[model samples]
Target: MFAKLPFRTGTTSSAIWQGFAGSVMLLLGSLGVGWLASSSVLIRTPLFILARTTPAAVICATVLLCLGALLMFRAWLRLSQHLSGWNDDAGPVLRKALILWVAPMMLTLPLFSRDAYAYIGQGRLMQQDLDPYTNGISALNNYFLLGPDTLWTEAPTPYGPLWLWLEHLAVLIPANSPEIALIPFRLASLAGVVLLAIYVPKLAARHGFNPHRALWLAVLNPVTLMNFIASVHNDSLMMGLVVAGLYYASTKRAVVGILFVTASIAIKPITLIALPFVGLLWAGSRAGWVRKFALWAATLGISMAVMGAMGAVNGLGFGWLAALQTPGTIWHWYAPVGIGSVSLGSLVDWLGGDGTPIADGIQKVAQVISILIVMALAFVKIRLGPSGGLGADLPEPQRYSHAVMRRMAWAFTAVVLLAPMIQPWYVVWLLAFFATTGIKDGWPLRTVFYLSAFFILIALTDQLSVFPWISMEVVRSIAVVVAVMGLLYLTLWDKKTSELFKRNKPDQHAFAVKS
Candidate 1:
């Protein structure tokens, strides 16, 4: 039945170019609708002026951006179908696709986020020798006029010392111009993208998964390109280093791997989750509890030493620990914590009482539950053997590696889902780890594909800086309609893509290919 359907018969190069063209469209559209600051030099550019002045231009750009996003999504879906057939050329094919798709994004202004502007402000704070972990960007002159969200004005930076240092350097290079500072920030993110390109496939290969499929899901997905490249989030570098570290650790280079993971923690403390698994990898699969405990302590000590050194360089001294709770302040309607708190808070409000405390209590409870789940996943043993021992079907090392990667993936998944604010990019953290274990071509793969599409749509609609003269409702409605139609076409109208949703047998060819 599957063979009877007309799958899109084209070279991977075709899909590559299709996505590249879409990125070009996205770049052009971003000029008008991206998160541009009021003081942006682009505001004086003719394209910006034209898009802002004419309602038709704004609508058209919005449509183009939506269309471009859908086109890229479709191209990604098409490329996924060919994963089984890819051989040694998979690396080159994916690299080509990445380069082409990222080119336009590099040229465009920041899309779907103004966080880059915040990085500039934070960097400016560092430039003046101010402690970014303690002083919000609001301390700078004209900070409010910058493109960052006002929420950050009084919020100390949540980023770690290495990232703050990089931010300082990025701003220094541009002579404190926020607009020009974007270049260095984007480049820093691009470097992370490069790290991902290099390491994700290698890790997949080490885990006995299809490197081609893993690369497709982890590196070329719309989520990675849009957030890591377009929005320039520091999480890109963080995830990249984590992937690289895990890869090295799995291959018996524990010290090198720990250093890489430490660097990742310096970028964002979230990857600290990867350290315990690193200790497991270091202790070897057959080690006793004593060895495991020692390795775990060693791993923690190594990470702390690296972190302490980073802190000493700037005298930042762990102030970021206090600011780590800052992201929890945002409440997204889609998050589990957010939903639970809001629902409970509304019930309390209906009873004629203050609900803020109830909401806070709910968040705290959810956080505790998530932490418990993570701990269970980390420590619990999987009894794969008939007599309650490790499975004998696979080698001990293979079993151990698989167990560690699975736990790491689910641990991160638990954190992201239960967090107070679930950003679209946060999903990238788990996706990278999951790819190493392999996304089987069934509901698991389909779920990831659809989720990526959903997040892309959310990102596209969520950040449009609507012109005051135009009706925000009208513009948003158009974007939603266009984006939904495109998604429907991919889901039902396109013959090749529609086939993706079908419950077909797994492709053996995918795993048969040597990494």
Candidate 2:
């Protein structure tokens, strides 16, 4: 089915052109969003003139931003196709595309979430010798100047101690200068992107898959670029380290893998679930099942000890564990648990009973069920035996690595699905790992592609701070029309229709070659 795509014949040069165009559009979109949502400190003086705060101006900026995001998604698809089978070295082409894709984001303010600013404020708290886990960013005094959302000002950080330890570097920058401090975190996120770029293909190569395609699916993905680089989220860091650790463990360096994955857990605890999969990769099929399970258990124990010691060293201890429920407070329809909670809560209220407790109980139960499902998948993967590559007769090591990758992918997917709260960026953790497992031209691929486009559009539209000048109904109508038209062109009319109209030429050598 993938063989019929028109972009399958596209060249690297054409793909790069599309990438450049996408970046330009993304820049325009980002600028629009900045004008509408960012504090004046984050916006350049000229941008204010270009993107006035009035309703019409905000609407126009929204259109421009949406158009840019859509164009970038289109270019990314073309680039992925170009990288898949084209024999010419993709390194230079990919690097150029990466630069175009990521450079504009560095200059943009945080887009989807105020988490980065929260990171800054938390760092300030730590710098003042206050325990960030016990106290909120407001403890820093005059922290509102940093533009952190009021929501998190009094809310304790939900991030792990290591993340806080690393974020403390922001305190070295002058006080009350949010924009300047923002640069360091953005750079750190960019570094994570670089790590993914460096390691994704290497991991793919070890398993006999096309490295370029893996890079395209994992690093060049629109969802990844938007959340990891554009919004400058720390998930990028955790994900990169997780992938690199998995690669090392698959290649027979279990210690190195353990270290990398441990760091990833410290960034955010979700990747901690990946340790068992790494152990499976390390043990391979030659080891007894008991030994494999033991290795997995050992890895987890060591990882926990390392993480605990690090937490102690920072003096933050395990306070983040208590704050794990923080995300549940920010409920939205996008989160599965949130949707259930809202619906159940509403129903209970209609039944003349207290609703909040019942809804919270339902959410907790759903989360626990998701965790159990993940554990079940992990055990099943271990017992399923070798599962990567094509056919029977592949090396045991490669096969084992492939199986581990699939299991790790499933574990991350479970985390995203079951978490009390989820955001579009959470998709990145699953997508990055799944990409390395060699998924090409299947339902899984299609799912990621469509989900990426849908969620990114949703995130862009929802994150905008609406103005009173234009009725939201008008904005919604216009956005819907533009989105439908853009999606139709990109997915159906642009190339699919052209292919349908072109006449099929007869095969010149089919009959003669038979003789």
Candidate 3:
């Protein structure tokens, strides 16, 4: 069925076949990973009886699983390349491919994060009339039934009121069956990805980019599939709403756009950064400075009112405001500011100074610097001009849309890089924006792709635990071998071989011409 779809000029029959084969391999790998690994919160399904138990079987499954993942990654790169432009026929094809790719994962256990279990627990808290923002999952006596990871057992929910209310609804359905309760949450995440698939292309086309390529980057990318869909992260819903809001705001429906963006903020407050950009998008070149100011003010006012109404409906009030700072307490190496703080602390200690205070000071400095940089960029984007100036000849709405997307991309990057606790999925915020605006074939684009692969490995390693017989040494060895082999195959054997043939073609052409 996929073979019949209309792709761009360069798409080959071989590429389609290859991608189908890779999807099959990814399905098997997902099954292996799901079967072998135990969930921290949920009970094992009856299907887990088929999981590899012996040393040899486990090792073989591990290798196969890694190979399948790499294969899936390669296939996506090929298929995305075939997606050259906004072909109307490509939409159904992309959706079909997405389903083929994601179907196997749905049958398997959650792939990367255990946040869904936490959501279940938080929802139970809300159902019990306990404010999730102020109370942790520990507040619920039957928290064990939900199987949330201990990391968040004592931590109050940092998510916004809209999410809390959604959690309430999720927990209320199929109340007796603990195992079945999680299906709703996963479906909700799936709904979010569906929204993204629809809006990303629309936004891309409006801003004069290849909507097909944008769909590939925003939806088919491993980061989106693994973190957003498989892991069922709330960021999926937030991003979906964000993209939809941006699309509406760009199309001159400023009121509708503000409401959507506000809803996203109600899911996760970090998206509040986009509110100002939306206001600016509504204030285009045609509007005078005074009108721009008034529009901005009106946008803020309406957004706040809508949010307040949502808060009242949920009965959660504004507790999420205090909860916003909750995530910053956790630190990780992936965060630039986090690692910097640790490195600075060690340096100060080595130099016979107080390390704790110095580390704190360094973190604050990094954060302040990032904020200032974002502010400067926003000011320049608003006062001066758009970054690429590609939309100068376009309509005012399209031009302003491109400008706001570009600036928002920068701001989102700053937020991710500077945050004390960074997750693999948070990068999607910047990626969704960039994919629509158009990524240049440069270092930044390359870096994003590289990071996607790197984070996949990191997430898999963290989530997929081997049996006791496998030994930590054997597991580490397998990981190292797989990483090296995958890197070599992808970079040298696959990509380099293509480059070599292309380079040699020119010489052959020159020789033929002379002859």
Q: Best TM-score goes to which candidate?
A: 1
lDDT of 2 by residue, 82-157 (tens): 6544333565677788888788778776776777878888888888888887798888767776667788788877
lDDT of 2 at 341: 85
497 Cα displacement, candidate 2 (Å): 9.0
> Lowest summed-lDDT stretch of 10 residues in model 2?
506-515
Spell out the clash pairs found in candidate 3. Answer: none
TM-score of each: 0.94, 0.87, 0.86
Q: Candidate 3: worst 10 consecutive residues by lDDT?
A: 506-515
Task: Candidate 2: list runs displaced more than 4 Å.
Answer: 1-11, 35-46, 49-52, 84-88, 380-393, 465-480, 496-515
TM-score of 2: 0.87
Root-mean-square deviation of every model: 3.3, 5.3, 5.8
Give the per-residue lDDT digits (tens) of candidate 3, residues 316-401. Answer: 77778888777776678877788888888889899998898877777777778777867665555454365546755456667677
Backbone clashes for every candidate come to 0, 1, 0
Reference-based lDDT, each prediction? 0.82, 0.72, 0.70
